[model samples]
Target: MSPQGHPWQKQPDWRILDTQFGSGNTFLATWLTWLEDADHPRLLHYVAVCQQPCSASELIKHFEAHPKLASLALELSHHWFGLLPGFHRFLLEQGQVVLTLCVGEPLPMLRAQQFEADAIELTLPHTCQDELSWFLKAIAHCCRRGTRLVMRHADAAETPGWPRVLTQCGFTLEPMKSDGDDSYRQKPSSFSGYFDPAWTLQRTRPTTKTGPLPVLRCAVIGAGLAGAAVATSLARRGWQVTVLDQAETPAAGASGLPVGLVLPHVSSDDCTLSRLSRAGVRMMLQQVSELLNVNRDWAPSGVFERQIGGTPKLPLTWSSEGTQWSANGHPDGDVALGSGLWHPKGAWIKPAALVKAWLNQPGITFLGNAAVTDVRRQGPTWVLSNNSSEMLCEAECVVFANANGAFELLQKMKHSALDTQAQESHLPSKQGMLGLLSWALHAEPEEARFAPFPVNGAGSIVSCVPTENGLTWFMGSSYQPDAQLERSDQENHLRNLEHLKELLPSLAQKLAPVFEAGTLHAWKGTRCITADRLPVVGPLDATDQPSLWICAGMGSRGLSFSVLCAELLVARMGAEPWPIEAKLARSLEALRA
Candidate 1:
């Protein structure tokens, strides 16, 4: 698309859909163009579909001749790993430029996405000619009126019927000047068009536009991971966000955990939760890279998980991309080697740091100790009140992200449509406070035997995190449901020691003396977990004009799921493309049956 005639020239954000990402040259060029433009759109989203994506070296090699684009290509290559068959979102230019790589078959991948493309660049390999009609039909499903389309092929004579296919797909072709130079690429034959159908076009769901959805007042209850994430996501979209919390400081809840593992959950079937965790970890890592202090607040040092009886197994669909994300066995040079999985993309993040960073974003105001006890609709605004019926804040939108507190608040809103659904779904019985106990030692029992990275399985151990008492090694985090809760610190330490023994027998023996001495520091927190084990996300009240939302029930995967769920929530509100696939997003729906 030329600058003069670009449809998204004056729009808040522009979205383009690329059918195949052969070398990523088009994406690089588009990004460069956006960067050079003095008045570029607020956001530039380039969604591309790839089948069996190349390695980072291969991607970087393609730009060897294009000196101007080489640095951009290198930046893109760094986050190009884990290109499994799913939607992989890359946040470039500090989240301004979004590159969503849909890795799979073109038609199926296009169906999985839900954004309205401002421009379309179609270039299919010769092998895809048979499915060209189907591909165009799927592409049309994501187009809006006046959506510009361009088709390029090596030889137009080979595919004379493509024009007919475009017509059937509801794309009206535009006349092109002979031998016109395509700004992005100059192919032998090129056809330009816009989406304009004659008859009523049917679709499973409406396409969503990239957004700067009218900035309004938004009150996010809970200054923890979920709330802070939502606040940041909304604030980035220009919303005035007020983060209200019961505690005196941000992340003064379960999110107050000093350090937590951000790793993917592996299952044989690559179940919904597993897929969701992978997406979440990817998003969380990107956020950490942009917002937190690496090696201090967080570290992408990787995690080794011992499977105890059996070796850690990846899903049957695991491929090279899976290896980049997680391997079946640990890497070399590990003191605590065993039959476990190595998650190279895994990390340990101090949730409070991330929460603080998110809350500190522009347009976001953090108000602690607000303790929103009741929520109700007043005309078009959502009114949040405290325990004494005193108003906390009134905003155009409200999101409950206080974990178990969300259920209690929702229960108080008797007339809420979502409240009825929550009650019928047995949300209370489906959720509970799960107390966890972790202990840290001022010194390592055996420094030489300590693994450099975190190890998890029966329980978890993170060695050598800086604390007020100096360097410390954290372990255990013994899981104790409310019923089996132990109030004594010694009992918790014993339980944590038991977990260490199960996870690493040899190391446990060395640390047994420390546990016996009761000199280890204890850290305790209660996490909210749901029966299905997935976080609740999406609109809680009216779906048509939703004003109330809930993003909670993160369990122990708060670091893994918070950013993803926050993006999903704000994406729905702004009508932007969902970060994950529609089916995967549905699993975390707040009002699911």
Candidate 2:
């Protein structure tokens, strides 16, 4: 179906076919209809014959200008622009809806293709021309025995007695609804063609169970952002949840950082990670802000990323406009704002505070210092233990939220096959060091607010955040080997100062004396990454083990990807629609299991 409206508008259970796609109106209407109805269709095949195929760029620009159709039009234009001819499919609503876009001459394409569709839409011109007859014939051949065709007549004279034509083609018409005045009288017809009465007409009855449903008790091994989010989601859905953390408090790992950046880590053509990160950021900001009153420390400050060392221009946001700007700039572009990129949406959050908020709710149990060194299943329940042979927790479902620690646990389970295939190393220069920097001259308190910078610099990301001691200037986000975790603070601080000088020379010059005097304090945290540089969030496999899940490898975009990953796991557990496309969800799942 043409994506004129939202694809989830009407849900169906069979394939869908579309012949004409002018402005994708009928296609979008059907898509939106399918989206609204949960059981609309299992598969949707959209075919359009465009003799004059408009450039995706031009179509998007046109859609942006319209009022009523602007939103839906922009969405469709994005999908179209992202399309590459040949059968391309997208999994929506957790594989419930599969969208197949076929760009070519619809009549010939339909004739060559053989798929049973529950619905078909034709947006033909007013006259019953030869082309229309050919298109109708092709559509008839493609429609299965029970297919429903929704055709829109351009004019009254063009309404070529479809009832008779359909009857001749072995289709029985069932008039549904009509819109328009007597003079215009444009009517819509629904027909069940050559359908199996047993399959289409039969009412489904619920299966009678012989036993009671099993109780679902889930445990999350980390209480950081990802674990907290996942546990909260499961708890909200009526699952008994227990959150375990080795630290005294949650978010004490890499997530313990005072502040973290929240923005879509986008790419040129919207890869799986880029798309999920974009959607994840949006969903996180919306849900987090609503669930907790922690907005004070979490303000949406836009991220300013610049290409270093003559790298190709990076997109400022994850939108078609951002991609165009980056592509058009070629080797060098000052910078461009993304289409859906909102600075307010990509805010800074106190990680620990957020995690604590998630644990404060009912139905969630927080257990600190309850490290699990081993996991074994006892029938349907999973049991965890510590090094001292003490029982940690028991549950039907278990999720691993520890970053690098996840690998160790999986290895212990003899399921080392679940190891992340690739790992990334950030050049130490890219790491940031945060500290408190006293102004050369003490000014009014209002001047202490954090100021946005156009490029990476030595200035603290959370300069505005004040503590009883003084204004905090966080720096030294430099990348170091995970093994360097034991390195001294002084060494890391000097490295961070060097990087600071590169980003802002003036700041280095002004702080030279302070640096020499060791007046600058520093902390270091290594950003964990996968070989593919994407997060791993979903089920884990263990030989004869009870339910096991994992939510890790968030890297530096934790604030942006964490909450959404939690939502994905929750949806998977509840068998509900995923917040992201199905392909993306699978892409983030741990590969081995």
RMSD of every candidate to native, in Å, equals 2.7, 10.2
Count of clashes in candidate 1: 0
Prediction 1 TM-score vs. true: 0.93
Displacement of residue 312 (Cα, Å) in model 1 is: 3.3
lDDT of 2: 0.55
Per-prediction TM-score to the true structure, in the order listed: 0.93, 0.60
Give lDDT tens digits, candidate 2, residues 241-325: 9999888788877777776666655455556765666566655665556554553556555444433344323444544434422
lDDT against the true structure, per candidate, is: 0.80, 0.55
RMSD in angstroms between candidate 2 and the native structure over all alpha carbons: 10.2
Candidate 2 backbone clash number:
40
Model 2 bad stretches (over 4 Å): 1-215, 268-272, 292-295, 315-345, 414-450, 453-460, 466-470, 542-546
- Cα deviation of 214, candidate 2, in Å: 7.0
Can you list the residue pairs that collide in candidate 1?
A: none
